[model samples]
Target chain A: MQQDAARLKVTREGDIVQVEFTSRKILDEGNIAEIGDQLSVLVEAEHRPRLIISFAGVDHLSSAALGTLITINNKVKNRDGQLRLCNISPQIYEVFLITKLNTLFHIYPTVKEALESLRSGSQAGRLK
Target chain B: MKHLKLQAGPRGQRQSREKSVGLWCTEEFPSEMSEGRRVEEKILSQCRKHAYGQRDLFALKLALEEAISNAIRHGNKCTPGKNVRVKYRITRQRVDVMVEDEGHGFDPAVLPDPTADENLQRTCGRGVLLMRAYMNNVVFSPAGNSVTLTKFNESSSSSDTPLSTTTVAFG
Candidate 1:
C-alpha cells in the first residue's frame, strides 16, 4: 500500500511499510493533523501491518506529533502489528528521552537496521 | 509566583555600549488550530532574527506551539467566536511568551502525568509535559486562563543571571 500527502510519503517494501516525513518541521497543527490522518488511513487499510516511520528530513517535532505517534502505535499494536521509528535527529531524540517514549517504541538509528531487525523475526528485544 | 520584569539589556551591564534589543508583539486569533500555528511561526521568525541557536530555537518553537495550541483548543474550546491572545517579548538573552484564552481556566496540578506507566500510551496530556520540559520556566495565572513561558538563550552570556531576582514589568 502506497500513500502520499503534502508532508508525508508512504511506500511499502514487502510487508514493511515505510512512511517518510518530508517536512523539515512537523510542528504545524494542520500538517500534524494531516499526517495523523494519513497514518490512520494506513492502519485502517491493514494492507501491510509492519511500519517504519523515517524522520530523516524532519528537524523538529512537537508534542502533537508525539500524540499522533502514540495513537498510531496503539492502532497497529491492537492488530498484532509492529511500528518502528528510525533516523530521529538528536534534538527529537532528546524529547523521546524526556517523555520516556524511547522505551515505548522501537527506535533505530537507520532505516536498514530497523528493517533488518523486523525481517529477522527478532521480536524478543525489538518490541517497545 | 516569580514575576519577570522586562529589562532592556544584559543584567548589571546597563552602562555597557552593547545595549539589549527588546521586541514586543501581541496577536489575537480565532480559536482555530491553523491560526494558532501561524502565530507560532511568526514568533519563531522573530526569535531567529535575534540569533537564537538551533537547539534553543527548536525548543522554543515546540513549546510555543504546544502552549498556543492548548490555549486555542482547550481553553477556548475551539469556539468559532472565541479568540486566543498571545503576547511575547524577545530580548537578547531570553524570550518571554504569554498565551491567554477567553474561557475558564483549569488547574494544571490536576493534569495526569503522561510519563507514568498507566498513562504512557495516552495520545493527549503530553503537551504540558513538553512545554515544561523545553522551557526554562512555565507559570500559570491564578485563574489558569493565562500561561507564561520563559526560555533563556544558552549561548547568551547573561543567561547565568538569576531569574527570580531580575523580574521587570513590561508596559
Candidate 2:
C-alpha cells in the first residue's frame, strides 16, 4: 500500500545535466525503469559531457536502482562523458559496497566536488 | 540432520531434503527487498556448511534474491491482499529456490533484453538475465506464476540425482 513518494528533478546549466532523485525507497521496477528512461533522454541531449546525480533525499536503493545507475554509466561512457554521483547516504553507500559498485562509479561528497572533478578532468578524491 | 516431509505437493518438493526456510508475505511491493534478503540469508547459512565455498554461494544468493524480488514486486503487482511464497531446498549437491506469487502469469520470452542498447539504461528487466547467469537451472511454471531456480553445489556428490526428476511435476 506504500506509494512511491519520490520525485526526480532534471536541470541543465551550460553543458552539465543535473539530476536529483528524491525518494523514500528506490525499489519498484516501474519507478526504476521510469528513472532510466528519463536519464537516457538527458544523456542524449547535446552539450552535456557531465551528468551529476544528487541523492540527497533517497533513503534506500534496490538492485534495480543500482542496475539503472550501471546502465546510465554505460551510456555516459559510450559518449566519453562522465556520470558523477553526490550526496549518497551512509546506508545507500553501504549497498554500493556490498555490490562492489562503489568502485565502478564516480561518487563525490557534494555536487560541487563532482562538477569540479568532471570539469577539471581531475581524479581527486575518487571513490574506492 | 532432521528433515520434515511436507505434504506431497509444491511445498514438499522444495522442503523435503533438509532444514528448509520458507517465507510467506502479502503481495506488497515495498517488502520485496526485505523478503528477498531474508531468504538469501537463510540460503547462505545453509549453503555455507557444505563445500560450495564463497564464490558459488555468493552467486546463488544473488540469484535467489533477484528471483524473489521479481515474484513479489512484478508478478504480484504489490497487491497486499494476496500472498507471495518463497521456499528453499538444500541437498548435498544442489540448492533449489522457488518463489511463487498469487497472480496470473506472463510470457517471460517477451521481456526486453536488459543488455540491449536501448534497455541498458532501463532499471527493470535485468532480474531474469541475472538469474539465468548465476543459477544453473531456471524453470518457470507453465503459467509463469512461479520460478524455481537450481544451483549446483561444487562439492556435491557426482552421483546425486536431481530432485525434480524424483518428484511429480505440477502445472
Candidate 3:
C-alpha cells in the first residue's frame, strides 16, 4: 500500500479544507510531524485559513498529537483564521476533556456543523 | 508459594477481585520508535486474547504509548545505544506495565500544568496527565527514569472495580 507512508486524507471545499486520518492511531512522532507540516502548508496558503480536521475513524491519539494540534491552532489564530475539530470518538474526547483542551478548541459533533459554524462565524454545536 | 499458585491456572486465570498474576514477559529493545510500537502490539495482543474490553484496550494502548515515548524521548534523550526495557503482566482482571530508559531521569513534580490557561496554546506536557487519567495507578521510579502503569479491566469481573487513579512517586 503506497498509502502506508501517508497519514492524512485531505479535501477542500473552497477555502475551507477538510483533513481526515488514514490511520487509526496518531501515536507516532514522525507521522504527527508530517501531518503537521502538510496542514501548515495549507494554512499558509490562505489569508485566513479555515480548517476542519475530522477524527472520524481514529481510535488512539497521544499527547504528541495534541501538541501538534495546539501548534496548528496557534498558526490559524495568528492569521485570524478558524479551525474546527469534529467527529472525535468518545474515548479520544475524554483525552481532550482531561487535558481541558475542549475549552480551547472549537469542537463540533459533525463536519456539517463545523462547516455551518465556520461559514457564519457562529458558535453553534460547540462541545460544552 | 504465590508463583506456584499462579502457575496452576490457564491464561486469564482469576483469583480475587483485588489481584492475581497472569502471563508476563520482559524484553529490551533499542531506543527506537518502531521497537516501541512492536512492544505495544505484543502487549495489546495479549490483552485481546484475554478478552479485555475495547475500553480497557484503548486505555492500555494509550498509557503504553505515552510511557514508552517518554522513556525514549525525555528519559533517554534519544541517546545512541541507549535501550528501553519493558516488563508487562497481563490478566483478565488487570494489566501492569513498566517501561524504563537508560538515561538519567527527571523530576515529574516540577512539570508545569499543561491544562492551565496560560498553557492552552502550548504544544506539550500532557502525556503524564493522560497516563494518570486512563490508568488505575501510575508509579514512577525514584530517579524518574521509569514508570509503571496499571489498568484494571472494567469487563473482567463485576466485583473487580478499578481503584481511583493515583500517582505514586518514590521518595
If both were scored by TM-score, which would come out higher, candidate 1 or candidate 2? 1
List model 2 lDDT by residue over B1-171, tens digit each.
Answer: 444434232335545343233232232233355556655677778778766765576567567767777777787776666667776667556777778887797788998865556654455666777678667889999999889888876654443433343433344
lDDT tens string, model 1, B1-171?
555554443345453213444666899989988788788888888878877888888888888888988888899898999999999988656799999999899899999989998888888888888899999999999999999999987765554332333455555
- Note the clash tally of each candidate: 5, 0, 0
lDDT, residue B127, model 2: 72
Candidate 1, CAPRI quality class derived from DockQ:
medium
DockQ of 1: 0.74
Say which prediction, candidate 1 or candidate 3, comes out ahead on DockQ. 1
TM-score of each: 0.87, 0.52, 0.87
Can you tell me the CAPRI class of model 3?
medium
- Candidate 2 has an lDDT of 0.69
Q: Tell me, by lDDT, which candidate is best.
A: 3
The prediction achieving the highest DockQ against the true structure is 1
Tell me the TM-score for chain B of model 1.
0.82
Q: List, for all models, the DockQ compared with the true complex.
A: 0.74, 0.15, 0.73
Ten contiguous residues with the weakest lDDT in model 1 chain B: B9-18
| Per-residue lDDT value at B36 in model 2 | 60
The reply for model 3, stretches above 4 Å from the true place, is: A1-5, A26-30, B1-19, B159-171
